[model samples]
Target: MAVEVKYVVVRNGEEKMTFATKKEADAYDKMLDLADSLGEWLQQAPLNLDDEQREGLSFFLAEHKDALGQILRGAAPAEAPKKAAKVKMEKSVATSKEGSTSEKQAA
Candidate 1:
């Protein structure tokens, strides 16, 4: 049997895309990571953002709210005055762990 190599993009418990080479896959992954970073940074500190940039960022957050939430939620510290926010953060972490487990299983 011949061995085949494929780079896969998995999202929300599903394989969304496949790449023929690892470099291509890495590029796509880096782009996604950059997008997440941009979203988080914009949310945290959006000083002096132009109208078009603000609109694009808003659209990106709206389109990828779930994924962006997971990224930001994980990075955020557990220090909030409201108990509900703290509890929500904990729940998000739990769900994130579960997702990591699923990814490990898939790998």
Candidate 2:
């Protein structure tokens, strides 16, 4: 059987997380799947801030666009960068706070 490894590339560098058979890697892109799912969840059931929501939506779009580009060029879904993660985390936290504030204000 041919052994395969999964590597996530970032601007600064790259990291290898899992080693699987070539078959397994083709069957499912573990890292991208989680990232896409989380990104979708954040977009669908967003917390509050319209701007943050918009930003998240934009991020989602950019991700998909990049994925499409990769597909066209015969590549796998790319790993999200650290900067994108940091921005998303900050937006999520801000959204949660805004959601709570709105709830308290309403009550």
lDDT of each structure?
0.71, 0.60
Residue 6 displacement in candidate 1 (angstroms):
2.0
| TM-score leader | 1
Tell me each candidate's RMSD, in Å, in order: 15.2, 18.7
Instruction: Write the residue-wise lDDT of candidate 1 on 1-107 in tens digits.
Output: 99999999775677756999989887666666666566567866738887578657865765565566655776433333355688989999999999999999999
What's the TM for model 2?
A: 0.27
TM-score of each: 0.36, 0.27
Clashing pairs in 1: none
lDDT, residue 67, model 1: 62
RMSD of 1: 15.2
Per model, state how many residue pairs clash: 0, 0
Q: Candidate 2's residue-wise lDDT over 33-89, tens digit each?
A: 555555666666646647566566655655466676656666555544555678899
Which pairs of residues clash in candidate 2, taking residues 3 or more apart in a chain or in different chains? none
